[model samples]
Target: MAATAIPSYNPSPRVEPLVQYRPLHPTFGAEATADFATITPDLVDEIKRGLAKYGVLVFRKTGLDDARHVEMSHLFGDLDDVAPFVSGLGQKNRLSSDYLFDVGNVNPDGSVMQPGTMRDLLLKCNYHFHADSAFNPRRAGISLLLAHELPPAHLGGETEFADTRSAYEDLSPDRKEEIKDWVVLNSQLQCRRNANTDKDGILDPLLDTDEFDPMKHRFGKHRLIQLHDPSGRTNLYIAAHAHHVEGMPIEEGQRKLKELLDHAGQPQYTFKVQWKDPGDLVVWDNTCVLHRSVPGGYAGKYKRDLRRTTVHDMGPQAWGLNGVGATWRSGLD
Candidate 1:
């Protein structure tokens, strides 16, 4: 296979929105106000640009009916089915199985996926920091979560989003230069442990065997902190799946990673939306923005269901900032 020039250091680039978010519905009709497109009036070019730059965004109050959600999500990019690791609602609780991906305490059959004593530790994963599909090389670049249900008190269950693209920018040039070619490992299983912590462990959960181990069986993938090859735009691929620096010591790597993650999740680079009512759909670039839902203490309350769809990433975002890597034409259609 042909290869492009390898970047000696991770380069930095400015970030922008791939699409200019325009309202689908005008405040009023022609009689009252003016006619408008309800689905993103912005051009497809605008959306392509938006997704490349922002990594994720939301189409507010678009009124996606039962079939519309699947239709519209497909338009942005390709669609990816729910991962098998999540809970399936089975026959009785079919909503999650048919549409939404069941996360957290996904005991649809009332049979604990884990043990009874491990429930609290397990559910904490829903509150941890991570991105969708950080484990797969063909991870979803964008994930659209339409808010079908929300909490009654309506506060804690907010979806928290942090823009790593912006966070990476805030670092000094020296700092970025220092780790340009560096790659961070995204261990799929470890991430599952963080989000699916219902097992029996205090820190990052691990496989249960005779001699317990954290790094065993869980090798990592190196993802970049640079550009989205095709669009030639810069971004950050760090998330819950992100483990540590490739060559650094476990202790030092852990410390530096903690600092990066802490800065990335700070209020400044982060945004949270308290989803209320139906007809609200949100999409974000999972590669650039790490997101997690505060599933609320009301998961089984009034029954909130949100259907999510994904677009496959054209290339693994492993080369940071260098403007080097595959292109959408070579990756996304």
Candidate 2:
């Protein structure tokens, strides 16, 4: 197969480098510095190249409002809307646009969600490491998350990312070959159930009802190991949403999936980004890394108002094994 050709970008003499990157991790993450006001087609290409090299990029105090945030996301690719998921839960849109996902803990009325509530339980799933929209037929490509409002420091609203590409590179050759061609089943319901079980042992009523059965819900089928084309590296695509492996007994497949997830989640292969200011932004490629929101003292006390825009994956593996034209379907829908 021919490599996808990327057009060369040359910045003007005044701004020789469109963006500058400082490595956050030796292997994966980076802090990017760029002039937001000077955004151009050439600059967008440079940012995309940066993302290809560093799976995650942090931009400090971007100072973008909801409108600008959405506008910036368009520079990457087609955006995925949160309306389906929002409406599936029988709730009205909270953000100004469906393109912006309200990942914060605040409700439509601007009140923090109380602990043990259905919404709270559902949000708990964010604590687990997973790629955005992996449960969908077309997985997410690049995700731009901005901190609109943040809790006080040390309250633990930080976001953490796992470097699956590096983790895969470090794996024993035998282990890599063993799972290279394996297919895994990913489901949003399974992720929610696991999050609830791990946190408070609170059985979500929805999970108990037939309407929300994990087994019955639509599962996104993808290879366990895949080539992250942009970086030309093979990465483990496992996540908390990965319910089980295909062509194996349920229990056996689950245990195998857990083993891989545990290996990839080791501290050495992870980086935590602490939200500093309200306007801080983090951009990550979901095709190569797994990310999760860190829970802390800010849980039910303070509001962590974060909004995200997910770009639909345009890579060759975007559809995985699912049929073309398949859309995001949540169990709640």
Candidate 3:
């Protein structure tokens, strides 16, 4: 057989009549500095529903303290400790990474080699554009990224969340059937990039021995392409980690992956966070959202600081709350 041409994912032609969105309330333009007052009843309810529907919600300018940040996150569920894969330091403990997740923030190849070292890593707003936790079965229920410091660049600190619910609904029935039971290998890579940024060197960017077990480093890979078992929702989890689709050919597999990625990141389905000031907190659903920091920004200015709490649904081997350090099921270790 020759090969199948990659499918295009334009929904404009197949969908019903055109629809548009006007803001619910006069769409108050985002403010410069969001006030961090008490979490209102309306805010909580909207956050819950938005997390379920859009998989992400962006809060601009809410100046909350550490205690309140953790307390508010607790209402959602337990939080996970910052894994070695992330860059956490100082008071910001539970985040996936700490300090600034920006480009120059991480050391050469992307791992933070040491504490308090200025490797010129990228700003936190320069997010890498991927799902929060596709590796675990109980993926991160929601991500709370609060901006205390904005990138000095002043333009691209905003985050883009694709409407994953609609993304899943738009999939062709045939494409849906093709990946019914498939899974993908999920791993974290922060090191091993050659000067060219294309050379693949090792399994992960770093050993990740503290957060992830060196033995289970290669063993924890769950599946090749994920189907949301809990919600019967379809979302792609493959990122820099997914190398192949279990039984699919190398070239063929890559083609399908690219098509999915391109379709997922379309601007029409995404919302960007042009950060106005600190005190902004964003909560998002990991299962139904794909996020990325627009690269090519804040290459060397501004120190981005944000705190995050990872929440997972009840699982037999659920990850414990992120406190002094990360503690998980020894089996997973």
In order, the Cα lDDT scores of the candidates are 0.55, 0.88, 0.48
Please give the distance, in angstroms, between residue 268's alpha carbon in candidate 2 and its true position after superposition: 0.8
Cα lDDT of model 2 by residue, 56-114, tens digit: 99999877889888887898888999777677767877889999988889988999978
Model 2: ten consecutive residues of lowest lDDT: 198-207
CA deviation > 4 Å runs, candidate 3: 1-36, 39-46, 83-127, 153-155, 190-196, 199-216, 219-240, 249-255, 314-333
lDDT (0-100) at residue 205 of candidate 3?
32
Candidate closest to the true structure, highest TM-score? 2
TM-score of structure candidate 3: 0.63
Let me know the TM-score candidate 1 reaches against the reference structure.
0.68
Write down the TM-score of every candidate: 0.68, 0.93, 0.63
* Candidate 1 local lDDT, 76-111, one digit each (tens): 665665433332312244343333444434345543
Question: Residue 115 of model 1: what lDDT?
Answer: 34
How far is 114's C-alpha from truth in model 3 (Å)? 13
Clash tally, candidates in order: 19, 0, 35
